[model samples]
Target chain A: MKKNFKLVIEYDGTNYAGWQRQNNAITVQKILEEVLEKLTGRNINVIGCSRTDSGVHARGFICNFVTETTIPPSKIKYAINNLLPNDIVILDSSEVPINFHSRYNCIKKTYTYTILNREEPAAINRNYVYHFKRPLDIDLMKKGSEFLIGTHEFDSFRKIGSSVKTTTRTIYSIDIEKQEYYIKFNITGNGFLYNMVRIIVGTLLDVGVGKMTPESVKEILLAKDRSKAGMSLPAQGLCLEKIYY
Target chain B: MKKNFKLVIEYDGTNYAGWQRQNNAITVQKILEEVLEKLTGRNINVIGCSRTDSGVHARGFICNFVTETTIPPSKIKYAINNLLPNDIVILDSSEVPINFHSRYNCIKKTYTYTILNREEPAAINRNYVYHFKRPLDIDLMKKGSEFLIGTHEFDSFRKIGSSVKTTTRTIYSIDIEKQEYYIKFNITGNGFLYNMVRIIVGTLLDVGVGKMTPESVKEILLAKDRSKAGMSLPAQGLCLEKIYY
Candidate 1:
């Protein structure tokens, strides 16, 4: 009998090509599928809830797969973690309804972007943060972020070559916070377009650093032109923080 | 006129040979001296407060040097950090008296050792923390640490080939705390012998696991033999946290 299981994963995506499986490079999905094959002794395809970008970290990612192995649900996470590499951790696993789909059942998603705004760049967290040597105006960034909140068409923040049929997406909220030398931008949305989170963060950073005025964010969103927005931020600073279903 | 200056440095020592200047390999001191030459147009020697081993990180390392550069002490840190690599940062700098010596005038030092106490090894902090897969008894580790606190002859914890003339060192405190899956051991002392902090942490970890009894720690100290102590922990887990003058 085949059993369907839901898996929650965490990974430092620095070495991964991305979450999607490809023949040329290593990916989180490929590794998960391979590990599942080894555990079940059968070829399987694992479907991820999100296709996180290369070099982007994830604290709570979800995936689903069907297996014929006799191993119980509780022991699957423990068993998989033992064989997985240090960068990839199977945080939790459980049996789900056979028809449950990790992607289609998702209600909301949250992403966080970290910026190290200090004179000296970060020494230890360089890979997890973007080192920007400037004092950012958090208040201005917050004011500019307010323009991005609420449901709207986010075509300006979407990548040029994205395959999505629609450019409209609803941003639920954007929270800007400053802790010591780190600036964190937590953004929640119904769905994000290709490179939407990074583009939004980049646009907000431009407003914080005086490159662009806070009022410019509104015009950029209205224009619906990708060139009106700032350059997309690096993937290292972006993390897939959480997913709700 | 030459001026003496003190610098508080932070570095990810994963790639460094050590804090000391050596003819072979890349050391922190060698890179600082080279950067100083570029900044001041004069060859200079930097005297560090402690000689940290290779792969040991530092958040607040102290060092002193004399130079004839006309750059103000307040701006020196900013200038030097620009030339230094991303992994090394000069956190602070100040002008000190001509006779000020970072190594001689230091009154206390603090170091922190981090252990990822979980089934899976860390991917994000792979260079900064040690991964130990076992159900560590924190209470037992804490109890064992009590015997090593206060002033004691730490000959058992000292590494072999150490040229220290005296084996006696006074430990001010040992703070052991477990947060989630991370265990941090912060130790403060008047002075530490070679590999003293690492060896102490290793012994406590052995106690945390069922490998050694907590009460056996006292007997190991009394034995005054290096062979009686546990193996020294990896250097990557150790960090020179702070130096108090």
Candidate 2:
């Protein structure tokens, strides 16, 4: 019997080329599809809810695929985990309705960018955070993030060559918190463009370091030019934290 | 003019063979010595305070070296960091007395072992923690750890192949703290055996999982036999946290 399965995944994307499969690079989608195909003895295409960039980690990424194997949903998770590498883990798996679509049904997505705000580099968490040696003003960063909330045209934050038809997007909230040497930025929205979270975090970091003023972020948004905003930071610091469906 | 210098070092240890220099494998000491030899016009031997096993991390491993260069000690930290790999960092460097020795002058050392006691495998901290899937009873572990406090002839916890004349050591304190999924064991002592911290943690984990009783640890200590205690845990979870001069 063919059944639609929903899987929530966690991966430390340091070694992967991203979620999309490529001919020359290893990707999460390629490995997952190969594992499914080997188990079910049929070619399969695993559909991911979002296309994460290279080196972007995920704690709760959602995906869907149809399989004809008689293995139970709970057992499939265990089987796949045993075959997959240590960096990728299946957090949960369940059978979904035949009409269910992971991408279309995703109501909201949340991303988190972690920055190690310290003079010394982090030894253990080097792959998980972006180390910024300079001091950052948390109050200024928070004030700058307020301009990112609510609906707006996020053209300035998106990558210049992105192929999205519309640059407008709705943001639900933005939260910034500090714990000792770590500064985390959590942003929730209906959708994100290419490198949107990283660019926004980069701009906010500029504000925190006194390179840019808080009110100038509004003008950058109004300008709708990618060059007016801060450059996109490294993908290793960004993570797909959670998704609501 | 020759000058003695002290360096505080930090390393991830995931890809290292150990702190001591080896013939076929890469070690922390070898890298430091090579970097110093290149910087100065002389062959250097960086003497570390401790000889950590393969895969053991360090946040504050102390070492010393003598050089004839006129480079300021403060400038060496930045220069070495720029030349060294990302996994190793020189946290601080300073001039020390010519008679000072890192091993003999070290009065106290603290080591920390981190355990991810959870059902799921650790994704982000896979290289820094030991993943124990079974449920661990903290009270039982703590009770077992009490037997290891204070001065004791720790022959049972020492590695079988080590060549120490006397197996006596003094432990100043042992602190156990749990934060969410992580359980950290910090042990401060005048000196540690070849595998003392790993063996003690392994024994405590055995007690936590009902493989052994808390009272058995006392008997194991009294026996002074290496076979009486649990096996030494992996070196990846152990870290040299700090040192007192």
Candidate 3:
């Protein structure tokens, strides 16, 4: 029987090349494919909601896969997780409709970026967080978020190879909080371009450091020039918080 | 200058064979000794407060080394950390008298054991926590802490190769707290025999699981026989919190 399965995955993406499959490097897709093929003796295609960059980590990222195998959806999670590396695990799995694509039918996606701001360097979470020695202005960063809201041409925020045809997307909300040594940036959006969230974070950081004005983000958006934006933030700080479908 | 220097170190301990220097396997002491030999031109002897077992991690385990290199105490921490692996870090360093020993001068040591109590296994913290299938009674675990406190000869909770002449130790405190998916055991003592703290935690888990009464721990301590105590818990759940001198 043809079936669609939705899976909630958690991964420490430091060891992997990225979420996508590649020839010379380790990837989450290749790991999942190997487990599925080994279990069912058939080639299985796993589609992930986001192609998170190398060094990025995820606590709850959604993905869907289709197969003609008669194995129960409940059994699939256990069977696959048993073979996965210690860095990746399936948190939840269940049957879904045939057309339920984790990427296409999504209503909103939330992403979080954690920064360790302190004098001493971060040791334990070095692979999962970006350590910035300088302090960031939260109020100024909040002002920058307002410019990113609503549908507009986000060419400054999108990477060069982002396959999406249009750069217009709605950011539902942006919440920033600093707890202890961690500064968390949680943003919700209807859709995001490749490296969009990370790029936004980088530009906002520039604003926080007094390098760029909060209003300059609007100019960058209107100018549709990538050169006007801040450099791409390190991928280790980013995480796919949740995907709504 | 046969100078004595103290080190407060943190290590993941998964890839390490143990804290002691061995022939083929990688160990924390081996790494530290190599770094010291290169930084200071002497074949230095290093001593750790606890010779932690394989896969047993530490947050602030203490160690001391003697060298004739004449490097300042302030520079030792930064210099050694530069050569250490990502899993290992020197939190701080200080100059101490030649008579000071990390083990002999220690007043108290604390350890924490984390249990991820849930049906699903963990991915993010696979190396840092033990996964359990059932929910634990937090109150029962807290009540069980009382039975393990105070001065006691814990022979039943010790390992076979313990070199200590006596099994007597004073437990300063036992704290149990339940977080979202983790039950944490925090224990402080003047000194612990080999595998003593892990065995005590395992016994308390049995009480939490309804296999033994909470008060039974007192009897096990008084028994003074190795066969009467609970099994040693896994190394991953344990973390050496601090060693006070």
Candidate with best lDDT: 2
* Clashing residue pairs for model 2: none
TM for candidate 3 is 0.89
Candidate numbers sorted by DockQ from highest down: 2, 1, 3
lDDT tens digits, residue span B52-114, model 2: 999999999999998888899878888888879899988899999998899989999999999
Model 2 residue B74 CA deviation (Å) reads 0.5
Rank list by lDDT: 2, 1, 3
Which regions of candidate 3 deviate over 4 angstroms?
Answer: A119-123, A135-153, A160-163, A173-181, A204-225
TM of each candidate vs. truth: 0.83, 0.94, 0.89
Candidates' C-alpha lDDT: 0.91, 0.92, 0.86
DockQ of each two-chain model: 0.55, 0.56, 0.47
Q: Sorted on TM-score, highest at the top, how do the candidates line up?
A: 2, 3, 1
- Model 2, residue A86: distance off in Å is 2.4
lDDT of 3: 0.86
Who is ahead in TM-score, 1 or 3?
Answer: 3
State the fnat of candidate 1 relative to the true structure: 0.65
Error of 3 at B127 (Å): 1.7
